[model samples]
Target: MPAWRRIRSLRVRWLVATLAAMAVALVLAGLFLHSLFQDQVMRQHESALTLQLDQLTARLEFDASGQASIDPATLSDPRWGKPYSGLYWQLDEVGAAPESQGAQRSRSLWDDRLHPEPDSPADGQIHVHQGTGPRGVPLLLVERTVFSAETPARHWRLVVAGDLTEVGDASARFARVLTLSLLALGVLLALAALAQVAVGLAPLRALQRALTDLREGRSQRLQGAFPAEVQPLIDDFNGVLDRNAEVVERARTQAGNLAHALKTPLAVLDQAAAPSVTADPAALAALVHEQVTLARRHIDWHLKRARVAAAQRLPGHRTPLAPVVDGLLRVLARVHDARHLDLGADDMPADWAFAGEEQDLQEMLGNLMDNACLWARTRVHVAAQREGDRLVITVEDDGPGIAPEQRQAVLARGVRLDEATPGSGLGLAIVADLAALYEGSLSLDDAPSGGLRARISLPATR
Candidate 1:
């Protein structure tokens, strides 16, 4: 392909290249137009020469024996008939008809002279030719046959001439103006292309800044502030962020629980050790084994949570908050058997999905609702809503609520306040950590039914 054609085929470089090309086209068009203009002017100048020849031919007359006559003083032009100003004429006699009247013009007979050849009977035709005229003035000539009406056999030649200095000068002046106009247009086009390049590529810069913000954790996901062309990219980027944050949070929570779980056995070992420098190595060994077991269970629970949330890692894996809430309540109904828990919701978008790993969603909801079910003696109330930028899930129970003084401690990692309950306090902590992972928050408040209200808020999916 040609270089210009190749430039147009590219994505990023086409605009500038096309503008530059149009400028080039303008120049070429100007050149062609100038040629057309000059050609028209030249044709008009030649037509005038032909008309002068015809006028001169009309004055022809025959003598008694049929001999051609002349009238040289009749050749006239208002603007160009001045002496030695390049317009001139000639007349002559030949055996039959002159081959060219141009050769018969007499003003520049042997000097910088030229005359047109008049037509004849056998090869009779008017002829125009270019040559130097009197005083070396560049000129054109028109020639034609001048026949006598009285005697058909007796005809002469007539010629007309013109100078081209004035035409050339005028053409040059017009050409200069035309050339300057084309150049100005080319310059303007170039500037316009530069502005277009900046304007067209602005979205790329915005995308770069948005990606940078995501990397620095200034934003949890790519949001609404983006150009339409780059909107899909921003959305995909947000999906990736959602998945990766879940992965990283799961890993951290597992690591933390592993560390927290080892505390009990180590403490027991410290207390049961024999009084020796080795501190009852067998007892210490047993304690270490128990701690390792506890760490293993904690790791297992975290792994399950991670798995449940992993659905969010896949593209378009968003789970609706309402369905999860409803499912949890159905399970609550079954577990309680004779008891009842009301799961009421209104104005929830039916297809509203949570932007999270599926397992993480399951784990958070499962723990919150299961805990609510266990404590809800008369009824468990569950509801969810989209609050500003969050998917808010509130699980409430009609049972006794935790004391305000102990609420903060209960939320602490592995700080189980209910010793009588057959479970770990990792559930609330895990839920809280998952909320933190999504740049969301969680809180505890009094429920309308005189129970504990667990409010879990996750970032709303785009």
Candidate 2:
């Protein structure tokens, strides 16, 4: 499918939009939380360094010569005496003192010193910064300038630094855990969104199934409870169906009434024109008879067309194939008892129904059976079965069969293969017309009994 079409679907669009929103929310939240945690960790680490700087300043001692010294045993943390232990302090003399004048360090400094910016600080002022410790390790450095309590003229720069690698590791660990936690949350929320979409659209699916049933003549209208959002549409659709059925019924009534109105006058005219009683000119009598016959044929054709137009599209009309065929066979057997033809129908399942009017089904089956009885020398066989959504019916006779080339011509109005056969030649044509009206088909083929076979395919119930 095209990307646009996929997005056009309501379910897909809902899922994509919701998940996109969720993903963006999770990403932003993760970033904000990571930054917050990192800042808090850094502040706590810097606080510890400041406390250490205070301790270093408190232990500082200076002589009148501006020299400073510190005893290793005075420090409380053992790392103060351990060389390159990542926690260290240093003291340097300021103002007129030689660069190497009063350089004293904690034992942890070993042979290296912390290199901070060369900026002087006011007396009793404290500064914090990032600097490099011994061996190029990253450090958080806190420095203060203080005059010795014993000698007011002696000033010393006191500095303390702590390793920053632990803070970095903690921040990195927090980021990884936060990303995983947020991703898991996204997955769970995505599933919830999908389930919500399915539940929300369930009514539309039910409506679709109901429409299918209505179209296939399975049920008359939409049924079952629906959400308020969709209930109005269902009610409106059912109203349209009702109006459609009403219109079709009205048309059928008009067509039947018109048929009766026209047929009565035509019948009277046909009887009046008959030559059984009065002997008018023979030529005039024959002319009147021919015209009356033509008029009658025209009337029948038009009336049948009108009836078919009205009947074919009416939904929710089903007639069982078995009962219709059985009833026809019973009537045909009695009607053709003199011929002593072996006429019977193969059993059809009760569920096989014609998705059309019962009268139409009777007309179709009655015509086909009557034609078969006329042709069959001994037996006529009728059978019906379902093929997919179609009902397939076959009527065969064990008599002289129609040639393949002539079969198509025989279905035309007023066409007959044998003129001697007493029929209006419109039976097959009417059957064909009604079948076409119902969107069905009829074909003639050779029967297995070496006779004619008539097969019809029509819509069937589910």
Q: lDDT per residue, candidate 2, 1-462, as tens digits? A: 888889798889888888899999999999999999999999999889888888777777666775677877888899988998889887776663455732678888887776665779888888888987877789998888887566777677788889998998999999999989998998899989989999999998998898888889899999888999999999998998897887688667656855664675567666766777465577656766766677676676767767777667678888888999989999999999999999988879888899988888999999999999999999999988778999999999999999999999999977988899999888998889888878899999999999999999998977
TM-score of 2: 0.54
Overall lDDT per candidate, in order of appearance: 0.70, 0.85
TM-score of 1: 0.58
Q: Model 2 scores what on Cα lDDT? A: 0.85
lDDT of 2 at 56: 73
Cα RMSD for predicted model 2? 16.6
The C-alpha TM-scores of every prediction are: 0.58, 0.54
Q: Could you tally the backbone clashes for each prediction?
A: 20, 0
Instruction: List model 1 lDDT by residue over 1-462, tens digit each.
Output: 788876664434767567868877997899898999899888999998888767766766677776665555654554234567567776655553335334445443443345443335332467777877777778887776655557676656566688889889889988999999888987897777777777777777777777688779897776446777778877777777776786788678767765666667667656666465365567667767876677677667666556545543356557677776667667666776765556444446776678876567777888887777767777666677777767887888888888888877777776887788767777787778777756667788889889899998886677
RMSD of 1: 8.8
Worst 10 residues of 2 by lDDT: 94-103
